[model samples]
Target: MGYLALFAVGVTKFLLGKNKNEQIAMDWRKNAVQVFRQEFDHVGCNSDAQSLALMQRSYSEYEYFASGRQNVFYAEANLSLRKRHCLFTTLLFDLTSQTEDLVQFNIPLNLPKNMPLEFLVCRRKDLKGRVSKLTNPGNFIKNPNSKHFKLSEAEASSKNSLMVLAEHDEISNNLIDQEVGLVLAKYGSLINLIHVTDLKQYNNFPLFLRAELQLTSESEEAQYTLLGLMLRLADNVAAYRMSQTVVQKCEKSRKQQKQEEQMQVKQAQ
Candidate 1:
């Protein structure tokens, strides 16, 4: 009788803990969406779906909130670009060996078809761990050493805390100029990585400028600033044109990727 009673108590405690954790996650999601909505409104973005309230689980331990196709008609750029993003808030317990849960915000902007470059910039400390976590069609590089050129001196500061890489030198030079570097340096600690690439597994956009931010606080002001920076990055990317040589290279790479994907499907059958 005592053993059965102890088992019942254990089960009750587990249930209570699970409920408590879920409540905390819900609260955080609420606050995050509120802040995000404010930024989207300021930028004249219409949340077509407002899908943050919908929860999805890719695996038992991972859960995320996705915003579906926030359309922004930029009269300034004369382009209609779409914003799609996901927030991965606090992993479930025992999902990883880490002691603390971290919140990640991933924002990707759909790019025009003419852009033919891939770019990645992040703090040196985050490079290895961040690359390891990126899975599947989301993965950026076949081999980091050969595929990516490390632009260690790009930021031009003794205290440079960034590790920059791009498929083309032109992309690294054009995108990471003084203004962009200042925004990145200001919020360097909060940023995990920002990259532009055409290799997303689910290729809706020919390319995308994606930023992954690690939210450490509930300050809407800071979040707004970071969000604004992302907008600036997208605008700058839209304005820049790739050289013909690089464009040809990117087109070749895309063709090869399609061929490999077709081969994999055939093998599966």
Candidate 2:
């Protein structure tokens, strides 16, 4: 009788929690769609909620939010989210405290001119944690090499918790100018990483910019500020040009990377 009563209480609590989560998801979807449609001329979104198991009833699971616009600095932009999915699995993996819900933005660009190099600037704290645990749709750096720069040194001196990884020092130095520094200094806590690259196998664009941010705030102003920062970054990347010699070096590195990829494929076959 006692076990049956406890089971009844557990199931009731689960159902109530599920209903609450569904309502919140619906509200979030509505607000997000309205926000993007206001910014874009032709905006589209996917508000479909992911199917969850009985153990996952307490969490929001995965929800996808996408939007796009033409005649802008970027051709299209979209957001994807992954949150607490399964309670038992999460506990088993020891990801209870570590799982800070991920909110990532992918903006594909159609630049009239090409950037000769690719670069990444990210929060140093996420190097071995939240950002690293994510999958391809959000992951930019498959291999963190010598290019992480001396961000460790910068982190020591400054209040900023950011890191830069670039094809060359010239690209990183030029891209992270005064304007960017000011933005980072002010709102550095909200951002995870910003990557400008043509190398993502999932994206077809010649060049694209991706940012992972923690949009936990429900305030409209905070959301707008985050979105605005992303736009500024896209514009900056679109407008940058390196010296001819630096461009040649970047192109050479790209070729070597391609040849290595091809060789790896041949070896696997």
Where in model 2 is the C-alpha error above 4 Å? 2-6, 9-35, 46-95, 128-160, 177-179, 218-220, 265-269
Against the true structure, what is each candidate's TM-score? 0.54, 0.67
In model 2, what are the clashing residue pairs, if there are any?
Answer: none
* Residue 247, candidate 1: alpha-carbon lDDT: 77
Residue-by-residue lDDT tens digits, candidate 1, 1-269: 99898678666655665554455445445555564455343322233434354242321122333332343222111111111111112233333444332344344554544565677776766667655543322424322442223334544343336666655566665676566767666777666667666567324555566566654345545555665666666666776788888677666776776787799999999
lDDT per model vs. reference: 0.51, 0.56
User: What's the CA error at residue 92 for candidate 1, in Å?
Assistant: 11
What local lDDT does model 1 show for residue 12?
64
Quick one: best TM-score, which candidate? 2
lDDT of 1 at 62: 27
Model 2: per-residue Cα lDDT at residue 21:
52
lDDT (tens digit, per residue) of candidate 2 on 55-119: 12235543433344442443233333232333344445535454444456677765677765577
